[model samples]
Target: MIKPTPNPPELDDTTPYEFPGSKRFHEAAERALDHYLKPNALTLRFHKPSTMFQIAPDQDNESLLAHACESLASASIMTSDIAAYVDNPQRHTILAIQQIIMLAELAVNRVLDNVEMARSASHN
Candidate 1:
């Protein structure tokens, strides 16, 4: 009878599987993946209204209305910007939202025009 061959040594989970020089390659790849995949914290922050539109303690009705108009105008611009980046199919929805924003902006502009006219008439 022939002698039985010995089994090869078992590799434990604690053993390093990487070849030489591969560790640095893997680290560089991980850094590149992280750079591309990581989301920006600043972009995820909640947005607040601009300080320019903030109401002062002594703000008048006309000034408040003007600020509202400016805010609506800004909203329209933002909606358009959002629509610009959207892909097809979903882009249609963004465009619809942009249209609604524009409508609201137009309505606010009309109100602002009427307020200005009244203010001018009163002043005269």
Candidate 2:
């Protein structure tokens, strides 16, 4: 029996064009946070090892957990590196980038948490 893989969440390709005199940067960040926190293709990539470790009923989920930790760490490092380049703090583009960085941070945190939970559950 061949089951189809589920599709990941779609990433937006269009640029965000904020009108109304360049206000609402925080609102935009809030919306971005809400959207980015959801699991997507990006997150699923991190999840595959977790799923495989479970399905194979391997010796342990340690490898998968390590992978998850690595993914989060990589994201954090990349976000921090990018943050060094921003000059104007008030630009919408800057806000959007910040939102994206925040989302990345959130994703990493969730991945780590899920990995820990999986390891803990497996011990029972």
Candidate 3:
């Protein structure tokens, strides 16, 4: 019968390794974290209370609708601009969002037009 050979150990104990530029790499990583990850003190101090849910009680519906239309139109334009530079995979999604914004703008404008017509008819 032939004798079988023994298998080697998983880890080698002979090599002593040292990474070059490790100190410089650590310093660069620390600087990047300090620059981008740390929160800004100025931003923390300038927090304003959100006005999203606070509608003025005295504002008229026509003015409010007009404002909504303007905001939607602006959003549509902004989305279109963003879509211009987006990759092909996400470009379609951004364009669809833009279309939705435009549709909302059109609806608001139609409501405003109807309100104006009703007011004019009442005055005549």
Candidate 4:
């Protein structure tokens, strides 16, 4: 019979992420451990970023930091999503970059919190 609705998707016995026997329920364990427990901790060195785009001086620090946090968050998501389609050792490199972006986003969030706290304290 030519019904209006299409056939339902077939169910699978297992999911792609069902690697309990392999990694044991933690997909990000290796990345998290590698990030925190590396021997001889790596130093964060900075290079001058391109000045082609910049926030206006009139913008408040909290707003600027908030925008930076959002931007880093987006970048981190992009790298992680792309990494899923990539094969190692390139996938490892992309994941590492995502980890770094996550760290930067966290730092920016911290600074934003500090600025907001100070602003509140000044108002009190």
TM-score winner among the candidates? 3
Model 2 steric clash pairs? none
Q: Work out candidate 2's RMSD over C-alphas.
A: 22.0
What TM-score does structure 2 among the candidates reach? 0.31
TM-score per model over all chains? 0.49, 0.31, 0.58, 0.56
Q: Give a tens-digit lDDT track for model 3, residues 15-111.
A: 3224667767887888999889886798768978798999899999998998999899889999999999999879999999999999889899899
- Indicate the residue-level lDDT of 28 in model 2: 79
How good is model 4 by TM-score?
Answer: 0.56
Predicted candidate 2 versus true structure: per-residue lDDT over 24-124, tens digit per residue: 77677878997878777777777745353354556455565556657655765665566567565635455566567567657766776787888799999
Clashes of each: 0, 0, 0, 0
Model 3, poorest ten-residue lDDT window? 9-18
Candidate 1 CA-lDDT value: 0.77
Give the runs in model 2 whose Cα sits over 4 Å from its true position: 1-90
Candidate 1: 10-residue stretch with minimal lDDT: 9-18
Let me know the TM-score candidate 3 reaches against the reference structure: 0.58
**Residue range with the least summed lDDT across 10 consecutive positions in model 4:** 39-48
Badly placed stretches (over 4 Å) of model 4 are 1-54
lDDT of 3: 0.87
**Model 4 Cα lDDT, one tens digit per residue, 1-124:** 7867557855668865655575554557877786778643233344456789877779977777888899999999999899999899999999999999999998998888888889899999
Cα lDDT of model 1 by residue, 1-124, tens digit: 6547545655666624367777777888889997789756775575555788555789887677777778877887887888788898888987888788778878877887898898899999
